[model samples]
Target chain A: MSPADDPCIGDVSEGHILRAILARTPAAEHALLGPGDDAAVIAAPSGSVVVTTDTLVHGPDFRLAWSSAYDLGWKAAAVNLADVAAMGARPTALLVALAVPRDLRVSFVEGMADGLRDACAALAPGCAVVGGDLTVSSVLTIAVTAMGDLEGRRPVTRAGAEVGDVVAVAGELGQAAQGLAVLFGRFRDGDDPVPVDPAQLAAGERLALNAQLRPVPPIGLGPLAAIAGATAMMDVSDGLAIDAGRLAAASAVTIALESRALGADPARALAGGEDHALLATFPSDGPLPPGFRAIGVVQPPREDAPVTCDGIAADPAGWDPYRDWDATAG
Target chain B: MSPADDPCIGDVSEGHILRAILARTPAAEHALLGPGDDAAVIAAPSGSVVVTTDTLVHGPDFRLAWSSAYDLGWKAAAVNLADVAAMGARPTALLVALAVPRDLRVSFVEGMADGLRDACAALAPGCAVVGGDLTVSSVLTIAVTAMGDLEGRRPVTRAGAEVGDVVAVAGELGQAAQGLAVLFGRFRDGDDPVPVDPAQLAAGERLALNAQLRPVPPIGLGPLAAIAGATAMMDVSDGLAIDAGRLAAASAVTIALESRALGADPARALAGGEDHALLATFPSDGPLPPGFRAIGVVQPPREDAPVTCDGIAADPAGWDPYRDWDATAG
Candidate 1:
């Protein structure tokens, strides 16, 4: 049965809510131990674990009125899993802490669980929601901690990009930002005119909107890139320009982007955010890895200009969680 | 300088906030890869890892007016660490997801970092806050995921206790509930007449307040209990009656407690919450582990009575995050 047909989260006890979640999201293969225990045991094949955390708050992160519970859950999983993937690790387990208002629906929790499971099954096989905490709060928050296994591979960090490296990307970019733009334009001034169905839209429009609501980062490509000898890597949660600037700063080098290679609007690719694409740098002579295409080149650091596009400096107008961009835009 | 002397979280950029946190909490030994990267890599010496998560929301879980940021941080670490210890693992790493309002003081964030560091240094040496995500939210929330190493020991699960096992607790109880009582009585409504200082309260009173704020669970004792042949174990975040009931139910047995052995008021021990003690059962033939005193005995499953004290059935009155017991009490 659909979560909407179930009891409201507030109407049922926390125990019921947990049972619902567990019933839906069966334990994946890698989980030596799953939920119902004080803690979970997960295999660490390389005798190491890669960990990253992300949080999605209701207001600043997503508009509750626009995104479904399933979307929230998918985005939460996508963003966190992408972080683990960026480190050249195989996504393994997730520990979630979900807090919602008492008035929320039980179906929302179930949809969320389904989203987490669906995302894991699709993006990173064997990744499981091993354990989590649920609490009550005025603001809904989905906090996720993702752990990964390196399997004896070296971690690809942003600091290893050397001058003379080829800069590349492994997934779509500028789509989520374009989707958010459409969402804000469509639902402006609290006037919601029956949100447009993603299916009803054109291919590009559907991709954009879905990107905004449920991002699917190239998770599997991370370890592949590392094995293929990529030196520096990061998930582009921020705009490409901003994230690339971070890589440049970390590596003490300059990234020179070729605008045409991105396929999407060059400016949007540079400035729009949340597509969660994988950006990496490889040795100049090494072939670009599968699922990745060269988009730029790494050059000696320039004190004032860390990242540039076609020889011009690129602005770092990435998403900042603290900014009230919605208020101004709305 | 103290956190109180710092800037506000809202005024600075995310970069500045990250810098401050990284500066304050340096990586520990196990972090093969630490902060400044997309994710952290930690050594899992046991080839497997124990993982757990917990969330502390602003209004429901704590009152900022009463509990300092330092207290919140320490408690977050303790509660999650305790879960790992309950599984007979040595706490190794922590990944924090912090969400707070824009108006929060930067000093608060700093104090929280310090608190996390202090708790690790004091309670579980070598454990570190290797990575975290900080975001802006309407309500303050601290979500922590703790990872532990079992060192090749068998995980003491809650399902192994036999009918003839002896039940024991590894830490204090009822103190946190008592502290909450004092806080509620002292600062009810918006009156806020400067909460009682923990130092000024009597030793017993101080213990209660401190327990409510910065719970230092006996993590070290958990491993000892497991090594000494604990059959079943769990961290007592809920009151003894409730958590023990859960243990009993999971093990398909009943726990009969001796009121005199608990050294606290029977009702308080059974109903109070947030004490975060270790509740374990061992074979009756084996001696109680060091630092544990027998408080109960396991018995065959009783259809009506799941947990009893002094031969009288004890109701499970554990803290329910979904329930607003505070508003009713106030």
Candidate 2:
């Protein structure tokens, strides 16, 4: 393809770029009013709307060479959807605010819009992009806010976990971190990132890469856990070790994990971030929800640490944006 | 103040920075569940929610030398709130997504939080910041999503205006643009922007600067106009000429404005951007809403242009981020 085939977004009008993106956006099921308006009206059936916002910025969040526009869009939507689901609500709509470099091609934005539509279709059936804002910037940033309906159920909050509750999880825990390791270890040339070559990846490595790029977190299990009388819930965005510790602190209980239940790589499972798996607690006597697997038990608060593995304190190390983001590496 | 006294955000944990901001954020009247949860649960008394998102980027949308952290936060909230107001809804909550450079001071972020709180208090009394996200980015960006309740009234969209409807506006027009002119015209060193000097400004220039920095749009008038039976409504972020043309196009009618009604500086009002005043249409027979004043009338569609001034075609020229942002100016 010739360079002229892909005109930069800077070369077009806002309406032209908007039309291209809107062409790819599917109709939202819960929207009473959609785009081309001052605001979108979304049906909040239970008289309450669940909302959360998450952002993916270049350098700290992703490297352009590694993440395609689709990957970036998918991850941005998935992450925010995970937050809404963690509150035991069904996602109804997404409002994306994109600030991108002017030099980027319009097709890149269309690819992102496609990814947003596909993610919503796959993860939450009725949810779709309802409205958005676009701005030009040197940094490529995707900030997505996902809204949801609780359908009359009480919201599941992290502070509700009771002592003696069963700690459970639904979705892969360490895969995303493994994918990050794969990229950092093999795909980088010196301090700069290089595009991934599928031929160089093993079967499991490819799976890991997909998990990192287009994570399919078990979003449905969130409402299922709530319906099954789960005591508390949260998305494990910053690994089990750190996130469980946070949950424990919020609930004023200690989370005791069994090392053997952590699967093949316990260390990575304990410290990995961005998996966005639902970490929840159900009453100890009740059977665990169908999609959820018990990994730990909630105990009375211990003075030593908020979380433990096989009765030993586990370090709650997780990705801290300010501390961990390496600007030079991106 | 010494730089040592104002620590960089990178020097602290995310929790530390969050606590500082959270301390300033007041509770929302409609928030069923606030911050600390995975997502905020906002009350939607009418069984539906009005949602909109708007972003302010460092280079294209604002310049740090000209806009203080407080000004940036206030303007970000004001713009998104106006969109909700334009929908004839009462804003209930705001979710902010902020991406800042690691080198920014924590105090700067705290000041932004203060501005967000004050804007909500002054503009929309019951509205407040309910949830937010923080991320690291090379370019500073503030993306805000505002949610509102329709209060059982039908949404007043831009497509509803009919021929003979009176075109009216609530809030100031072109003031923000005049403020921008003041900043660009007076507060620049070569190509780079410099801090605004109040001492050098005349009284009216100060008001213009305030309008640009902290816009106090007539937010309450939106629902009032809706109650008074507005046929169509939209915020005038772009100049009246461009935005009215959009409204006219949406409604398939021609908006004929009286230039005499457009204040002293009609040309500036027609071409300036970012004022965010509410532009609406009402039945010609009805008395104008208390806070709104008539500016024009709707007529049959015109082949030449959607908007006209004194029966002459008006150019729909306004700021285009991609075309107008100068990289070296900021």
Interface RMSD of candidate 1, in Å, is 2.4
Query: Using TM-score as the measure, which candidate wins?
Result: 2
List where candidate 2 sits over 4 angstroms from the true fold.
Answer: A319-325, A328-330, B319-323
Local accuracy of candidate 2 as per-residue lDDT tens digits, B119-228: 99999999999999998887889999999999999999999999999999988888899898888788989778899878999999999889988999888999999999
Proportion of native contacts present in model 2:
0.93
Name the TM-score of candidate 1. Answer: 0.95
**Model 2 - which docking category?**
high
lDDT of 2 at B182: 89
Each candidate: chain B TM-score: 0.93, 0.97
- In the range A101-143, model 2's lDDT, one tens digit per residue, is 8899998999999889999999999999999998888888899
What's the CA error at residue B282 for candidate 1, in Å?
Answer: 1.5
Clashing pairs in 1: A8-A106, A9-A105, A9-A106
